[model samples]
Target: MIPATSSTPPLAELRGIGKTYGTGEHAVDALVGADLAIYPGEDMIIEGPSGSGKTTLISILGLLLRATTGSIRIGDREVGQLGERDLPALRAKTFGFVFQGFNLFPALTALENVALAIRMKDGKAKDPEGQARALLERVGLGPRAHHLPADMSGGQKQRVAIARALGGDPPILVGDEPTAALDTKTALSVMELLRGLASEHGRAVVVVTHDPRLERFADRVVRVEDGRIESNLPRLAQAS
Candidate 1:
């Protein structure tokens, strides 16, 4: 894994993180003793096989789920110290999410979809439609702005999803299996866009993926297995 160029403190930090589901003997540990630091403007990728707890780690980092044990620090504030009511607000302001399914509404045009997210993120957005158009343009989807997701290709749909996620300019952009559905070429294109989010926009980008081919775009790569992060991970190479 490559180290970040910045000498600044971590934007988000996790220590001794553990997670469990259910209770009693039925409990299953999804993650254990995971220590991670997300630096600003870094593109980090989390990789693991099926049931390796990679997704769980991303969830905890994105504040989508609570850790059963460990300290989660976002900036100077501890996650545990924040009230339940504050979580949604904090998550909205701190992270933008992209998922494998694209998550675009079939009924809405690409511009409408992005505009909706902008309004949802900041109800007082000065000009949501104009900002939405600019976002679509940024993702190279300006021509498809009026088209519904059903009329778009998989890559186009994902780009629209990315545009929507870019709303509010969240500091951290989290992606879960974002390229699992794309062909190799399209996947690389999307990964490049994600990497640009970190390098060009100064936002931290964290993605959970099973593809080693995507590692070249990452500044840091983490491997997890059996609920624990491997200490000495092999260097990423071209994988079949």
Candidate 2:
């Protein structure tokens, strides 16, 4: 089902999405008829309890998994029915992902981590070090560029992760529990950095986290429970 095109269409749209595991009495519905529209220049937060299917929802959004029903559109392209071979190109080109655990290579330094991402996004990246250092500097990690993940604090490691995610200049940034491992101050700092990036580039930022502290940073807060969205509302900042 195609949605009517708007002057500025959503970076990604999820309509009547459903995801189920198993079958018969043993079946578990992880998501049910979920509808969401993520736009550029907005930071959207999806929060809920541990079993509320937040991760499942993000998995589908990142193209790491498929919905059982309904359609998903990235910009104007409907990707729900796209074949496996077609998904990697679109996902690499459109989405950048950061995870709860810093998924950096243990052996690689921060600069190497970001450079690898640049190479993955564009096989022929010119001066990968130049691009990597610029991204690290953008994330306020220029001084830590040569540091290994083990040598940096959690926040710094996450910063490297974020910089790596930005390698392709993806239109959408997807974070699953991005700040979960950081302390309060660090988490807020990370959130501020993410918000600033999204605002500056008009890119969409989607985060699936259970931290209530994150609510204040979101333009829209969505609550998911029992495999369904309980509420989706704009925060005061966006409402004004």
Candidate 3:
């Protein structure tokens, strides 16, 4: 379903999405008629309790999982029906993901980590090292470019992870529990960095986290309970 009001079309959208595990009497409905729209330059937060199905929702949004019903629309295309061969390229181009764990190689330096991501995402990357350093600098880690993850503080290591996520400049940045491992202050710092990416860099930031402290940074806060979007703050944030 297309958004009715036209400020900007959604970068990605979920329409009547549903996901079920198993079948028959043993089936579990992880998501039920869930719908959402992600827009550029917006910071969206998805928060829910342990079994609220937020993770399944995000997995589908990132193209890592397919829905049993409805559409997963990215830009002008409906990706739900796309074949496996067609999904990798589309997922790579549309979203950059940041996992709960930093997910960096212990041996790779900050610069190397980002550079490797650039090369992996775009095999034809020109001057990968140069681009990597610039990304590190963008995340305020320029001087630590050569340092390995073990040598850096938690915040610094998370910065490197964020820089790596920016490699291909995907329109959407998806973070799953991005700050779960950090201390309070450090987590806020990392969240601020993410907020800047949406506010200053015009990238759509979609974060699935249970931390209530992070709510202040979002333009829209979506709460999922019992597999449905219970509420979306500031109703005008998107076209329903």
Q: Give TM per candidate.
A: 0.93, 0.94, 0.93
> In model 3, which runs have C-alpha deviations exceeding 4 angstroms?
1-5, 235-240
Q: What's the lDDT for residue 92 in model 3? A: 89
Candidates 1 and 3 compared by lDDT, better number: 3
Worst 10 residues of 2 by lDDT: 1-10
True lDDT of residue 190, candidate 1: 95
Candidate 1 local lDDT, 1-240, one digit each (tens): 234344687779999999999999999999989999887788888988999998899899999999999999998889999999999888998899999999887899999999999999899988999999998998899999999999998999999999999999888899999999999999999999999878755689999999989988887778899999884232353231
Model 2 per-residue lDDT at 179: 97
* Model 1 alpha-carbon drift over 4 Å, by segment: 1-6, 231-240
Best prediction by TM-score? 2
* Model 1 weakest 10-residue run by lDDT: 231-240
Query: Which ranges in model 2 have alpha carbons more than 4 Å from their true place?
Result: 1-6, 237-240
Give the deviation of candidate 3 from the true structure as CA RMSD: 3.1
